[model samples]
Target chain A: MTEQLRESLSALMDDEATELELHRVLGELESDAALRQTWVRYQLARSAMGGQPVSHARLDISRSVSAAIAAEAGAETSRSSLRERWVRPLASLAVAASVTAVVVLGGQQLYQAGSLEGQSAPVAASGVSAVGFVNSLGAVPMRASYGAQAVPQLEPAARTAYRELARQRMYQYMQEHAEHAALNSPQGLIPFARVPQIEE
Target chain B: MKCVARQLASSVVCGLLFWAGGVAAQGPVCSEADAEALQWLARTVKSRSEVAYQGVVTLQRGDDMQVVQVARSLADGYSSEHLTRLTGQGAQVVRPHHPLNCTHPGEQLLTLGDRVEAGDCGLARYYRFEVGPGERIAGRQSVKLEIQPRDMYRYGFLLELDQDTALMLRASTLGRGGKILERFQFADLSYDEPLEPRSGMDTVHPAAHPHPDDPTAGARLSVPWIVSWLPNGFTATDAADPEGPRRTYTDGLAVFSVFLEQLPRELRPGEGLARLGSSLSYTRGMHLADQPVLVTVIGEVPVNTARMVADSIRVAR
Candidate 1:
């Protein structure tokens, strides 16, 4: 890990960083022992005044519960994949990783959905469109958000449609990335410019 | 009595010696087999990123299937790509650049190198590697390297890397049953040379309109909603919580939007789920933990994933 990362972890220990900084550190460091120990120590220090122990067990429970919910929600979203029951748990696991990742999400959603009330006034007054960009491996470049008007109400019918749409889109997006990664993989003989046509 | 005590003490010393030796052997060390696999995996991933290559890949979703022919050229932190469907659409092509998504020009994107480290023992922190039985894929022999999760928070991955180049030829998402939830299989592939710099630039040109001004851009948003919990590795990459309209939260892997438009008090929308093409959305109504609350989760993950997220939405007082 870079010194900057270690320093950030230290800042987290001291509660000197913003929520986003903490999230970034957690995202990359969650899998690292040295980093995780440092984080646990920070939590203890932060909660020391209250004499509360770091609740790793509680955190794990929350993660599992959240993942389960996400997977069930995904089940109702996709169509034409009835036989693919095996994907449910895996989907849940992916979603579980986002459990402790709230602050950034909470803030971003507030911003994206224009729920920040007074916050949007200045930006809107400045004539800024709240467009989102999802960065992927270079080449697809940038695909803009569907625009502000695209945010439809969560009506019963609309909600159903939205769920379906989300699953299909995600699968396609991930598949596309995997394809690109595989195509550029260092093996076999086909050149990058001449990948054979794939059929659906 | 003294002779008996001496014999007992000698036995205790022998036990201590054995215990120390066991502990020493247990200390962390990379086995030769693990070293070979990791070395090959690291070299393969690095080389793949910097090369021009092509392949035919089969993507399986549940029971549905799609085959794509792909071409990619990597040069100078950029990638040029073209994807054609042999069975469906004429050819849907994409020439993506390194750092794949750029909302604003000149914004530096994080690379794979920045996210994951290299080395035989390095990845052990994130994953536990286990070698499994060999399987033939895409007309070639392959070995399965199962990347099991060290924690329950993330999914485990089963990879079939080519025996020759160590290139990952096929991969699957594995869950509770050792079941394959989703998979991508390469029919054929090859990288001719190490990647070059100019490759990424060729396909990426800045958008004509970096920022667009529109009348509807400044839509009003309602709020007081909250999410009870979020996973560990996720962080909001950006926010649009301003007054112009709704709010959106996204992790690199998932995105959720919250629209807080005040509905007519008479509208008591029930929880509903739907699919539109590839996306999924869920809607639920309630009085915010304190105020009236209506929550909706829309994303490209499993339905359970969305529902859990939706349920977690409680209005902050």
Candidate 2:
């Protein structure tokens, strides 16, 4: 039976297996470690044949993703039921109010960093753990500056001005790089897409 | 019994053939044909300036995506390009066409043939080009060209060029472990379209042109600042800028610029790194000639590479 199941799994890898064989292979895959190993080997082999790079170690995140979804669902139900009782009769009004609230709150936070922190602090204080948000978002890891001998302290206003100056200079450099790349790169106008869309 | 034996024999044969095929497609094999591919790529570069086209392209970095509409035209060896953001705030930028003679020396080398040899040689040393399977993109058949970097200093690229026009349809920057750092692909494209006259397109024109008579023009200075180290195959391309004395370097593919500028007295010195899309900027504060100057290295390079370059700056004797 194991030999038959392995043959079926290999056939499924080739996409030549019948539906019955696929079902049989999937059913055995859960309890059979040897069968799972065979399935992985078959996948690796297929990728190799396609001339694609394959990662040796695989990290499956499906279980964690499912857990996150379940947690979100639970949170949503517990929070929304109370609101639903009061808001169901005035759905349109409530939606309009919520939309206005979001826009006003979002705009205010965009201009004020202190308010942004205050907004996030409640979530952190509530024990929801903002670290999961960062992980789920797959944010780029920040790199620390290398070879920093000393950091000079400055007044808050001066620090903000300095940061603004640095940002402007960086933007200038980025624009110059993009313009030069546009003229030089063999890839044609593709380089132009790299230019940041500076909003007025 | 006979039928079972026949089925087993066929399955065994199929598996053997599949395994053999896998073994054959291992890695890029260098050959004389690669030279031809290089020449073809060079021709494509030249053709970009001479040909006119319009396309809608999507740029993807991490989870962010932006769509841009681009139009290009070439007249009398001068190329003009207009790019508009299809998404976001609908920002439009129009770059006026400047004659080839008015362009900087580095830009000239790229357009002219002198740098082609250097570029080709550098390419040969630093990258391996492999021809991959053909696919259809934006309703056009494209051939995949895989450019694997010889070292970690530079990222690899997988480009799909239109088989007929040699125009690039899709390009992806591959990072360590073959992860795609960024991707640019044409959603739709048209080649050799009639050049449209600049009209009421809500365009943002540059305030002033860098004319030959301008003081900044032809002001290539021999700056005292120098980078102690650079990635392999990278060479300084342009002469130092007169304004900031910025230095630009390229490895025939990736490019980076170094800027040394004076900071305000009241401002405190800080070192930091930032990334926007695939481009990164690393800034460090240092004392140059008794004045506080910030050394910034900016490029579409890996963050560590940018930091390394920023840290490697020193005053030349």
Candidate 3:
């Protein structure tokens, strides 16, 4: 955005804009997409500063998220070329978070669909197989291959990832049981040994 | 013995005998050996809470092994343990061991003195406790306390308790036919049998911990999920006052937890099972009180035993 139009946005946010400045901001907002985006940011920042929520409107996060994904994709491509790519934990976490989020949301949807009148869980609408999602998330442990469901042409790495997720889920139940056991068992802290060393 | 050991926290031994044997309105008689084992169990229970120690423990299941570093501390009326997994996953956690200042379950019974008859420690009907010479573990001499189950419903235990403090140095869960199910023993320990007091010890000291009959402790509330069946001798722990989604019970020597949780979505699987070491967890998803709920029975019991417990859960009407 140009300096003149940017100043108009600032003036408009402060509500100190003259009729000319108001018109300029409004006129520029129509032709300049960047200026409109800036105006939203300005209003958000102003509203937040004043301790007032602008509106309960969902903020636009797609652009930033897409930018982050694009940047990560590049990093992933380059990292795969190297012998060691252990450093970028945050980058890997983003990918894992995205994967788990999809799994959780998809599982919820599939489960909810199956839950109606106690029907069987259909395949996830996201096209992931229902095999692991239905079986693994149930109260019991089952022989499941979540990665195979993720990619029918399974890579060994995918199998490992699925195993990791299953292990994480299993630990959750184990930890809950361990906490109770620790309280009443004759061996106080010893029961806690059963608890896995992983944080959810 | 664990129930008696737990009873040492507060409930009367004679009172327990009344329930165990149900012989008469008067407390039933417990054998002299039963009473001595109860005393040993009481000491063993307290030692784990009041005594502070740091050590590395090795746990072995049928084919799996885990090593953990544990530091136990008694401070601020609260004893706590900091455990770090030395083997896989590097999981670390700190949990409250037990409250020293808070009324321990058996502290009141200890004050009962002569009432704790070497004759009737009151747990004999369910378990036969034999205190025998223990082999040394982690450079400390121990006394072996074998709790043999009176029936096939529950498993037995062989515990190597620290001779002086009664801290359990090694413990093994005995399966059917005396099979070794799981064993957890200290690989090495930073030893000091006598507990040292730290600051926070200066609290409003109660002359005695709350007794089982303490009116203010309130009557036992019914847990939400009704367990229609439990292993032969299992009863809700006297000190268990949990007002949450889970409740634990003990046959004294063996403990199991009943967890009731609402599922956000129903799972397609019918009965789910998980096993680690001696612990078996059985999860069954069923609607209760017009809500989707998962009833899980997790215990150091046989898979079939846990499955029966899980099957027996009903929504308390």
Off by over 4 Å in 1: A1-200, B1-45, B96-127, B132-134, B139-143, B150-154, B163-166, B192-228, B237-305, B314-317
* Residues B208-284, model 3: lDDT tens digits: 12223222233343345577766554655443344246556665566677766665553222344566777766555
Q: Which model scores highest in lDDT? A: 3
What is candidate 3's lDDT per residue for A75-155, written digit by digit as tens?
777765343356466565664454323222322333334433344432211211322343332322212545224222222
Q: What is the C-alpha RMSD of each candidate to the true structure, in Å?
A: 20.2, 20.7, 24.1
Better of 1 and 2 by lDDT: 2
Model 3: DockQ score = 0.06
Model 3 residue B131 lDDT score:
77
Ranking by lDDT: 3, 2, 1
- Residue B16 of model 1: what lDDT? 55
The first chain of model 1 has a TM-score of 0.26
Q: Which parts of model 2 are misplaced by more than 4 Å?
A: A1-169, A197-200, B1-30, B98-120, B195-203, B206-223, B266-270
lDDT of 1 by residue, A1-200 (tens): 55456555544433444445555665656467655443432332122112211213223322343454455567646834655466755554444334333322322233333332222200100110111111111111112343322222212223333234333333333332232222222322221112223223
Model 1, global lDDT: 0.41
Candidate 3 lDDT score at position A160: 35
**TM-score between candidate 3 and the true structure:** 0.55
